[model samples]
Structure formats: C-alpha cells, structure tokens
Target: MSEKVIAIILAGGKSSRMGQDKAMLRVDGAHLLLRVYQVAVACADNVYVVTPWQERYEDLLPVGCQFIREARYEGDDVKQVETHGPLIGFAQALAEVNVDPEWVLLLACDLPNLEVEVLQGWIEGLENSRAEAIAVLAKHEKGWEPLCGFYRKSCLLGLNKYISEGGRSFQQWLDQNTVDILPDCSTDMFFNCNTPEDLRRRLL
Candidate 1:
C-alpha cells in the first residue's frame, strides 16, 4: 500500500537563543519558513505550519500554505504566561486540521537546508519497511531526530495522553511506543538554526 502523509511544519517555538524568530529569519533572500514550506510542498500535497503567533508569519508564509494558531498552556510561573511546546502544538493542530493521511510528517522550520529529496526518501523508506512501527524517525550520532520524523496518526491518542499526564519529555514519550529509527540520515538536511552562531556559520 502507498503511504500517504500530511506534512506538519512546527514553527511555534520561542527563539530565545536565536534572538529572533527563526521562522522569519532570511536565508538566501527567502524567509526560513518559506524556504521550508517550498520544500514541503514538493513532498506532500497537504502541508500546514503550526505557530504561536500567526500574524507575525501571515505575510511570510508561502502561497497555498496554511497555519494553525498554537493553543497555549498555562505555565506554572507566577505570571501565568502561556507556553508553546512541540507536543501541545502538535496535539492542537492534529485535533483542528481536517486533512487525513497515513502518516504525519513533522518538521521544524528552522532547518534551513532541509531538502525535498531527503524528506521523500524517508517516506519511501517508511512505505517499504515491513516492520509495524508507529513512527519512523532518524537517528544521528548524538540521538534521535524527533522533529524531523514521521508519526502515525494512531499515536495521537497516546501522545496526548502522555502530555496530559505531566509527561513532557519527548524521548520518554517515544520510549513508551514503538518507533523505527532511520540510520544514516543526512546531517545537512537536519541542520537546524537554533542560535545566531548557526546562521552565522554559513553551514548551509
């Protein structure tokens, strides 16, 4: 069976280290989010970006691309501010979006060099794999590449359950379920911009 995927781009994080929104950061004349979106469009038919502030990126998004306004969780601090994390935002978007597919292609918009070919290669591997796994994620020498991975829609319930029960650790959450880790994933495709040094390094 041909595996279908709904590409979900995660762009809702607070870029505290980067000193700027990584989504809007320019790369070779185009915004980072737009660059990722352009690559995502080539890999899947239905693609969406999930962000905390939609207006901040409304003009920067590529044409035909849509985003979900990330629902915030009340933080434990005295100020009672809202927090935007990958799990919460992912759950919210999956609940609100109408598109249905065999797998959810999760991506981080900060990856300036993420290629359409690499994304498609992962999908092909998933389709060809005989193992019955809930998700297919890439693992580097350091650890698993959680953001740039594929998750089966069936895992949504377990994921939300873990989050609701005070579980925020991504690796711990994955430990509770079956996941296929793709080895030898391209390092360049997963090179994400987290700090100013990453952008300044010209790694791309």
Candidate 2:
C-alpha cells in the first residue's frame, strides 16, 4: 500500500560547530543535501528543503524538490539566529505545505550515519504500530532524536503550543505526546556531524 508521506529536509541551521553549512558538505559524489534528497525520494511522494539560506542551496536542491525559506515568516523581533533550530524549521515546513500530510519524515542533513535501512525500519514500525509519532531512541545515550523521526503533521499543533508556552526542549514536547521509540544501534550510527573533526573521522 502506498503511504501519503512527505520528507522535510531540515537544512536551515548555522552549522556553527562545523563552521560551515552541513547540508553542503560532501560525503559521496553528491552534496549532503542531495544525498538526503535521494533518501527522501525513496519513500516520499514529495520532498522539500526547508532552509533559511535558500540561495546557498538553490543549486543543491533537486530539480523538482522545492526550496522553502523560513526567514520569510520570522517575526520582526526574532533574530535569524533565534529561528535557526530544527524546531523552527519543522514549523515552517508544515506551514509551507499547508496540509496535515500523513507523515513527515525529518532528517538532519549532517546525520551521515543515518542508514536507509534504519529509516525504513522506522517507517515500517510507525505504520505497523499505528502510533501518533515514532522516533529513533538514542540507545545507551541520554536523549531522543527529534530531528530524524516520523511525525504525524498533527503533532506540529502540540509542538507549536509548546513553543507558545516558551518550551524549547523538543524531547519534552514529544514526551508529552503519544510517541513510540525505536531502539538505536549501540555504535552511535545516528551520530551527527557537528565539527570538522567529526567530519574527518566519518569521512576518513
């Protein structure tokens, strides 16, 4: 059976620790953003790059996959930096689509270790379990990975409410909802690149 899902590539980050845009970083022959778009295409009917710097990635986004900017919606008082996280990106992504898509598969562009098999497993689990949300649990680690997860677009309402209440913890918002956790590999395969050294280690 076909599922009506959309993949929202959260690419609007400063990548301050990595000192560059992680989405533009290369792993294989393609840029990281393209690689992510490939993965998203494998499972989604449509995919989009949610970025604040659309110009920087205009060349990287796939021909058909759209580029939607988040900066356009930022309130006058909220600095760009203030709206730079995945939470803000996710919200903007939903607003741009303007539909409660069946599911939104979110992926952090710097997550080089995100295996397609694991992502497929999460999709299967979420579909089979019939849960409101399903996310990868950082096994043997301290937090839930809210970035690379399956969200029912409806969950955005609660998350938006959380933001209204000044809540910044993504995990906290997920914890308060009907969320299912998929056990992660012990080898830290879900590790995200946040530094040059991390990129070196993963690339080399």
> What lDDT tens digits, residue by residue, belong to model 2 across residues 19-114?
887888998667887887888888777788888778888777756668777874455665545545778778778777765457788877877766
The list of candidate 2 runs beyond 4 A from truth reads 2-4, 72-82, 99-101, 130-140, 183-188
| Weakest lDDT window of 10 consecutive positions for candidate 1 | 74-83
lDDT of 2 at 121: 68
Q: In model 2, what is the error at residue 187, expressed in angstroms?
A: 6.5
Expressed as tens digits, the lDDT of each residue in 1-204 for candidate 1 is 567788889888878899888888998999999898888888877888887778778777755568787866656773454655887778787777677677888888898888777777777777765456778888666667888888887777888899889988777887787788875676678888899999988545
TM-score of each: 0.89, 0.85
Query: Can you give the lDDT of residue 53 in candidate 1?
Result: 73
- Indicate the TM-score of model 1: 0.89
Clashes (backbone N, CA, C under 3 Å), per candidate, total 0, 0
How accurate locally, in lDDT, is each candidate? 0.80, 0.73
